[model samples]
Target: MAAARSATLSHLISTNEPPSLFEVAQLRRCVQTLVPRARLLWAEYKGLEERLQLCRIVLSPTRRLPAEILIEIFSWADKKTLLSISLVCRSWNASFNVVSSKSLSTTTMRFISEDGIPCHKILSWLAKPVTGTKTLNIEHEVSYREIRCKCFKPANPCPWAAPDFLNLLAKNPTPAQMVLRLKFSSPNCLSRLVGGAGNSLLWNSLETLHLQLTGNWSGRASIYRNALDGLPKTLRNLRLKINNPKDRRQPPPIEVPEAPFNTLKSLGIECSWDSPLILSILRLCVDLDVLIVDESIGRHTWTESAAQVTLPKVHTLRVKCLYLHESEKIFPLLHLPALASLTIDGGEVPFADRNWVLARSLRPLGLLSPMPRICLRTLVVQSINGLDGDALWDIFSHLRFLRCLVLQRVPFEGAGFLENYRRRTEGGEHLLPALRMFELRDLDEKFDATSFLCFVKVHRHATTRRHEGGHERIQEDAPDGLRHISLRYGDCKESRKFEAVREELVSMVGALERDFGVVVQMTRG
Candidate 1:
């Protein structure tokens, strides 16, 4: 009888008529008793499903694939997906690490402090030997918030707050190239590397060193001098960048070393202020092959003795001056007898600062005169404020060997600037007669596209003109003509009218490429 009663209670809800209050209470009690058990069973079922999926993955046929095939497959994935794949299993992570290590020779590790504590990842990564790293870049940044945090007490300061990488670096093989970018609130943070005797031996195998010092420079001149003195003399290429913010305090006197860097092959300097100390350093690099000078201000005056320092072997020279007056100081000073490539960048003037200075002129570049038969094959000029096309043509007239010309954001004073190119096809001696590569970007709004088309037609006929005049032209002397042409227009109000002639430009470029074997790339705004 009890068994029958239990069976009837189980089927209490099977009846069509609604249950009475007592029957409904009995049903509620039954459900409450089974709820916890149902939850436990569902969780167990989910665990089993996960284990089954894992078993399938472990027994997959793809696991037998060769490392080369796996590497090729991984190469097709983006960085984010590849990283996720690396985290899936230990074997996959090891394989991906091998592939990545063989592909990249340069590795950059950045250390950012939080509440006066060093990053644990960097510390652990340093604990192991970093094999196959040709160039190691270490950037240490200390934020003011971290230094001023409540947890940062001077008496009980963090031991790893300041960078001390000597012990860590000794574990790895000596790298050929090292780049140190340091930004700190106090100068004492550099004590480990700068104030130690192991400084010279630390970089014994270094051939290239790029040091960028940026931070509070209230009294940093001496520290900078010491840092330079401590560097290894075996460096062949050295680049120094001084990113000092504007300060109201009196500028500290900088004393540069009198010793020359006789082994240096290339030297580059970028600074915000004018300093005679830079000239002193340039005078020392007598065997420099390439020189780059980029300065932002023209306030300091250079003495006559320090003005004309000649670099006899320099074949490539790049000068970037933000102010118009800076050109007067830079051009007349450099005498490059073997100059092959010259780049003059007149930096852009912000819209807000345009009121202070109207435009920077390229007329100063003309000051580098009497250069020994300009072997200049490449000339790049961009973002000049007030450029005169006629005067610029006069500058190009001298570069008989100019083969590649790149001009960008150069606002000309008058229209028909390209008319000068026609003179080359009309007759005798002309400007840029050997130009084989021409690139123009962000052309002026008022520039006439019809004139440009005419120029291209003349350029196409340039070499034939040289053969015409019944004069026996040497086979080697014949110009290559314009073989590569690249034109890009920006999307702005000034370029809308230029877009109207896009169809005509495309047709002309296509004909040039098909008929003359010229490489042409043209993009409409």
Candidate 2:
């Protein structure tokens, strides 16, 4: 066997030309003659050489980075950078394709078409690779030229009229459930999109819809109604914002179907000057889990009777208005038995009003009810113009289950602002036993830091007393005990006051951490 192996090794080296069949046959015969260890070593050396070559290529600086790393770099880049990255090279182009496709998977397309329709190139780019976009926004701006041009030249197509674009959507049926948000400034463009001869049918697959009417909204209610009539059954969320400068000549109300959205869970509406239309929507979207109403669209009178209308089903409510008295009256009408969150902004309720009986009585009466006493877990109040400390204390004192409280742009200039806060934190008036998170924003320099520190100190002392007496001990850890404090100071141009305020805030945070072991985060804007 050893002699046979030696003969095979000699045959292998004896080939002058690359091995032919006969040479390979002779080498195999020789391998049968050699010991097993030499054969194994020869095979292993070939494998090592191949691996070393691969490693050199991988570690070479001139070699292109892996596709995954390139994609990450693109993700961190902005839109302009994304465009530039696409132009780099062939490998980069392929990498960009994969990265851009993934990035646009949840992308929102918002068109500002006041100047003109989005160029065809943009539409073509969107239709390619079919990246399954989840949201589409189209905002059209109307101007004097656009109105006059369309009126005089009826034959000429308006720049924003893109039936072809809508058709493109039909061609590439993206699998993602989508949200279509459209803001239109031109009534002509709106009519073209949703009128009798419009393309409302293209929105058949939408899961969420948001519409904002900015220009000539009065006469366009018919157009909107027609558009809504074609809304897809899959829609689960809806938001409408209408701002009509010509609201003085009241437009005829659009008769919307009650509970227009059978599967809808969220609804938001912002109208400049009308409540009847808003009321119609509220009555129709009965099964909504979230509702938002913004009254800054325009000034209009709203009454308590409006809230009396039964809501189908709602678990969360957010209201932003300038009138607190009117808002208070409406709160009782909301049937939100399952509500776990409530937010109020710019309400007129006097912070010191001691009318707990009235306030409690106003809780919605019906199958839909506010959560049971202490069931509400989150409450936010912001931009309240007239509420003082006493009024806020009175309101907050009753919220036994509130775990988070946020105050923003709250006017604390009233006569007894500080005093009322002190009273609430004192032994007899202390409330919010379950409160774990507190946030304050847009506070003036003088009171921002000092007042906050004082409040924290009072609460800390009260908590210590509870622990000492063997009562239900308050937790020492934040959120668990009362964990986080967040403060956002509004931008003040006065540098001197800003500096002083910063110093005071630093001192306040230091004291809290040193004494109570609470975590505080401060943000300046």
Candidate 3:
């Protein structure tokens, strides 16, 4: 009977039909008798898990960053980046402040002045320790608007800008390259700046200084003199302007005082060479190896005393002569025994024009018998209108030691000379026998491309091949013909599919490389 009763209870528990009132009462009694502590423990465990999750939310990665570091991150963001950050959330927008450098050497800092901010403040930012800047260029000619800004209350915005700049150099870590370009400034600032130059820290570290002084030069020699005197001996390269005195009545300074810059290796004078100031500076540069003289418009001719300079150590000479006939006269004055490279650019009027003949350009070297030919191995002539075949030969024939020749901006009219030269290549007369590299730039399509191939064919690899003859042996020892020919021209030389001449030129260039191990490069402008 008891087993039957237990079976009936099991059936009732398993069945899905509605339980009777008696059965419900029985279930309730069973639940009331269950273990109370077990239920209590499960509820406690769930509560703890929820609290642990809340702790994790509080310790998120972003919350770990320190306050100062976060500010720095915001500071580094540029205006655009900051705006984007601001759009992301109100918090970031509120924190956005200013952005602020690390061997700033070789890196250029471009500072555009604004109305409210002073230039001194801008310079201070440049001198910041983290900048490590080795090159600094301050230019006032940014834009027309900046010049006309209204924040500058004084009649002169920065009349003292030049002097203040000098002061900044003294205080900041001296940079390797410093260029100051100002406009319409008084000479008095130069005087005041140099007066305090002894205190400038730049004297010890500055290697190259380029100063362009734009103003009237009346009787301001004392200011210029004082400034030039402050230049330290450590300066190796200098580019300065020493304009001729406005008063022609004032003769050249009776005694030229030599600046104490014996270590200078290069000097570029943008002043009138006629100024005694320039000549005296040259005398001080005993070790100057490279000299570039850029003449001002006032005067082209130099007095006899100013012209004569014996720069024996100078191996490279580059002069911009405005006058056509002045170069020849200038050469007698420069007894450059060690001159190995020469670059001459004829202003406006191409040197290849009728008046400026190749022979006339060289008249200065004194190409007579006992007077040895200029031992220039490298020569560069640019902006030549036209050089006839004979003129080109005259220039090349004298340069026995010629190794590299660069002709730039040479018009197509002159380029035909190369064809004439090849047709009349005299027997055993090797023009440019030692030539190793030839570069012709800025040529149009009219240029004789065929002459270039012929020149290479005759000259290439001829240097190493020994010919059994008296003076011919020397030519063999001379370096082989042109090793490199770089041609840079415009649209005319562009390769076309059906152009036979262009295709032939391409084939010729390829053959030279394959057969003679030469490098022929063609670049389109």
Candidate 4:
């Protein structure tokens, strides 16, 4: 009788019913009555009973999913869903803690508050062992002096002062795969952070480092040199940018150690002037594969002086000059046997003087004698005032292996420039042999009818021939033939000229497609 009554109670509880509060109460009483001895059983196995009751209430097959499966489900969810899951119950909270620990491991902590309050919280969090942190980026704006004042205050002295964050880093070293960006308002703060008691600890595990120094502080290079002198030998990449004039005046000449970074592969530096100083620093990075020098100071003359410095092994070089004079000497530095790409900005070559720049620029290519066939595949030329289209065409003609050519503010002074361009290439069978992409920006309506037309016609005709080796050798009847042009026109201010230029460009593209069967795209600014 007791067994039959217990079975009956189980069936009633398991059924999917819209039971009232009274019905639920009566059901509980009936179940208890069915198994009076169950009270003793329940007391002896209280945890199991509670779990069984919870399973019936929340995990029954007729209802929803089981807790374990739901936990796994939440694990696959994104940050938003996980946050929502955390609010459900104690079980979910614990589950969330486990998943969150793993998910947040990839995030770097950034303290953005200007005041010291956030700094304290960050320090507290960092004080604990960060076993899972892969990268730590600290972009706090708090001044070191402020932190020192607060931590060293007498009223309620904190044992872990501002510098303790560094100390903690030193004491509990993270894995060597971590990357760090430590930006500071002043060099002094950077010095304090790196050279303090935590100095040895913080840099030991760093694999990549980026430092941006801003504000009124001077002597950043000195501070950086001192702070980074003993950095981990494992550093693979380094980027340094000093924007403040005060700081630029005092950049200490980098004292690169012999094989300073045994594993360093890339180095990028942006500052004003100090080209010789920069050259000296670059020599130390013997194994460097990429080098970017963006320093504009002291009239264009500085560039000429900078160009005199030699970089023999650099594979990639990007230079932005204020004046065009220095550009004349860039070719002589092409001792780089492996140079594959080159970019120059803010240089203007006159229509009459274009050949001079081209000849000198090509001198470096000549230096690679036995391998005179240098595989220089990409070239970017940006002119501030404008480049004479004829001179540009002449320049492109010489770069036999040039694959990409970009012209900024190319000057098309009416029919003269276009006629000169056409006259030079009229008899020549080929143009930019390896050129596949061409871009022209900041042009006027005249550019569309003359300069654009001449380029398309010359290259289109040349490419149709079988023997043509330049950009002109497009496959006959092939849809992918030579001309793929992007033209950008217009000034910042609005003008009626815009509509005229657009119409001209549309007509030019239509003619090219209809007459030459070439595709051209026009985009307006």
Relative to the true structure, candidate 2 reaches a TM of: 0.62
- Candidate 1: pairs in clash: none
Each prediction's TM-score against the native?
Answer: 0.64, 0.62, 0.65, 0.54
**lDDT agreement of model 3 with the native:** 0.59
RMSD of 1: 11.5
Candidate with the larger lDDT of 1 and 4: 1
Worst 10 residues of 1 by lDDT: 147-156
Q: How far is candidate 4 from the true structure (C-alpha RMSD, Å)?
A: 15.2
Of candidates 4 and 3, the better by TM-score: 3
Off by over 4 Å in 3: 1-118, 124-135, 138-167, 176-188, 220-227, 245-257, 273-277, 296-308, 324-329, 350-361, 366-373, 412-419, 422-424, 461-470, 473-477, 491-502
Backbone-clash count (model 4):
6
Backbone steric clashes in candidate 2, count: 21
Ranking by lDDT, best first?
Answer: 2, 1, 3, 4
Could you give the candidate ranking by TM-score, starting with the highest?
3, 1, 2, 4
lDDT (10s digit) by residue, model 1, range 1-525: 446446757676476777668767766777787899999999999999999999999799888877777877887777788899899777778778766664454556655544332434445543444455445455655565553112122343322333444444444444434443334333334333444424445455566777665554544455444445655566778777765544644334554544336668888887655556566678778889988877556465645466677778988877765654555565556666677787777665554432223222223344224453446778887666554555566566666677898887766433355565555336565556677888887864455555665566566666546557634343476465778877776644644565665655677767777777687776655
Cα RMSD of all models vs. native, in order, equals 11.5, 13.9, 13.5, 15.2
State the C-alpha lDDT per candidate. Answer: 0.60, 0.60, 0.59, 0.57
Model 1 residue 319 distance off true place after TM-score fit, in angstroms: 2.5
lDDT of 4 by residue, 87-171 (tens): 9778778778877665544444544234332445544544444345455566645455543223211353322235556556667
Minimum summed lDDT over a 10-residue window in model 2 is located at 359-368
